[model samples]
Target: MGARLLFVAALTLGVSGLAAAGAAATGAERCAVDDLERRVCLEAPARRLVALSPGATELAFAAGAGERVVAVVAHSDYPARARKLPSVGDYNRIDLEALVGLRPDLVIGWVTGNPEEQLETLESLGTQVFYIEPRTVEGVAGTLKRIGRLAGSEATAEQEAEAFLDGMEKLEARYAERDPVRTFYQVWDAPLMTLNGEHLIGRAIEACGGANVFGDQPRLVPRLDDEAVLEANPEVIITGSDEESMDNDWLGHWRQYPNMAAVAEDNLYTVPADPLVRPTPRFLQGAQSLCERIDQARPGSGAE
Candidate 1:
């Protein structure tokens, strides 16, 4: 009887030791509010992470968690190292089993691009999910800081966030009050889509002393017919292309409409698609390029 009692006591001690070890491993609690307005908390810095979107992968790297990332989705090629990581799937479709197999401690998801069901599944499986969606320049900066806090990379994240804010401030000071050039920013070629003022790109245009012709459109991104383009008669037209060196075919198509002000002035321009389209720190690169293009389109700035 005494031997059995001693065995039970040893078993109890073992369980207590395990509990203590778990508590020690958890460290301190950290929390961040995501774009979904949900508060996500972690007992310790994420040791293994998975990013669900290309943009989120870049943001996680910026947060100094790049080394901690164990999985990513397609097109997350930024920072060079991210490309070497395993891919669970793309933004639209996720491979649930593959992602779960990675045993990620945290998952970063895009509010707009990622499927809600997949995110829900991840959460249901006891994985922490943080949704990020930055719609404005300021929002992007804030996201970096928040992500950094969650990942325990606060110092690096803060420095990057400050640099981004400073860069944006300089751009705003340089171009905010310049002559307003009537501009049309084409987002897609096949259907001819443009962003309204509510969109970040539209705000970028405004900051560069250019007016988006479709700024008043209700839709964030609206499809416009050629007739609308002819009617607006924008002073300059800008579009993002996949290749930095290649001019988009849409620009050539506009050349046929010689009467169009942008066509007549030779103001159709193509900027690098990566920085301009993605809501990452590289947006400043695209913003600078855009400002230069708009300045070139100005009267006497030089045409063709």
Candidate 2:
């Protein structure tokens, strides 16, 4: 922690650095930035905004800056008010012309996940973007603090971050007593893809006292087959529905796998599918929900 503070201190040597860098998430933040950081940096108390991910949208709402968002990605359905905001289309296939029409002061999205080509185009068009993806649960707090400062809602951000931190500590304590469960989390079954460990979701599973069946695999999302899954023989299976909604075909396909532990136990579930899909504040809710399902899959594994 001391080392981190020193790093931030050097990064924020002057007003110019403050403008260019996302400020340290501790105290009163100066949203001011240098001209270069001004072009790329985002200081909050942001009036006009666009959020291109469900997590980013919710983080804004959680930080009490929901009123500032003027545009959102098409799939960002949360807090009801987010739905009312103009849609800038999907993240991968963003409609640049439509986004520009909204005339937002700041645009928020994931730094790594979104298309760099599109982001480059947005930058070329003079749209300053903040790309943040929280890895651990604390990362969510750090992100909230950063967004809060950029949006000029330090008090709200701190409060929201504190509440999340407390919830996470409780979760950590709950799992401290037990050995980790061998669990398989299936994001998709067609190609048999699961999250890579570097991802926030996989880390969430590790923190929940359950081991990712594919923890050794090293991609953000790796594809596998029934043979690979069978090799793991996970004690529990945590899953969410597919892109086809809960339609008959999807359910029927899943039904064929009933012999599997997750299927045999009926451990499949329906999460928000929006915010839960992303790495944001709701990820705790997602992890908690997944934990609940896994506990059901194996009796006496977790809280009722």
Candidate 3:
């Protein structure tokens, strides 16, 4: 009797220890992470998720956790798969009741990138809201790894990281020493909204072997006057989607500028804001497409 009791007690202790270890691992990595941004990413694994940021949505799908996602924010149309997901809200807005109805285990959003009011409503429901603050391509690797760990797929995440690094290496070699194209990226037309170097979209311009004409501007969105654009004199003008929320009609407006060098040479390009704007693994895919496009435009540049 004594021997049997001892064996049972030992087994119980072992089970308890294993359970504790699991609990420790499942606890979001944020509270423990020193960096605020990395910490937020650590809080994923997010079954029944509501993705508020386009980047986070891309990351979730890339991590192979798409089945766990319940809904995605508007305009997450990349991967062709994202479009099939249900809607939670737009980038800066949310339908709080709809999000609550989903009973999401996690809600991923952008820190300071989203409007405060929308964030608060989600938080009030006791849902874990993860904020990602990826600023560069390098930063994206960290986000991918952390998200993978949270989702219990570290191996997949590492593979993605390796693949991205390899692709970028080839891109760099292909464009190394080639003449840098001065490019103008227009986000909007009425105000002539353009991107600054600080944002991921602008950095993507550099990634594609081009220099942002507004590289010096600090704000993500800078309103440039017509004279400023003329002064910038971009060799290639890359505009995407429609400014008026209409199907990409840049071609219509672009035709009016027959005198512009980009128009004359047919350098006007349109990239969808959905996948192109998001900062996930697919983002590299989009940037790679951009590089291919730029290489095609320049012609003598080596194509990887």
The model with the greatest lDDT is 1
Ranking by TM-score: 1, 2, 3
User: What is candidate 3's lDDT per residue for 89-164, written digit by digit as tens?
Assistant: 7878776666666666567777766787767655554555767777787778767776666666678888887787
lDDT of 1: 0.85
Residue-level lDDT of model 1, residues 85-167, one tens digit each, is 99998899998777766667689999988999878866765678999989899998999999898888999999998999899
Write one digit per residue (lDDT tens) for candidate 2, span 249-274.
33334557667765676655554444
Which scores higher on TM-score, 1 or 2? 1
Candidate 1 segments whose C-alpha is farther than 4 A from its true place? 1-27, 302-304
TM-score of the candidate numbered 2?
0.78
| CA lDDT scores, all candidates in order | 0.85, 0.69, 0.69
Model 3: lowest-lDDT 10 consecutive positions:
29-38
**TM-score of model 1 (CA atoms):** 0.90
Position 218, candidate 1: lDDT? 100
Error of 3 at 16 (Å): 20
Query: What's each prediction's clash count?
Result: 0, 9, 0
Candidate 3 achieves a global lDDT of 0.69
- TM for every model, in the order presented, reads 0.90, 0.78, 0.77
Query: Which candidate leads in TM-score?
Result: 1
Model 3 residue 242 CA deviation in Å? 8.2
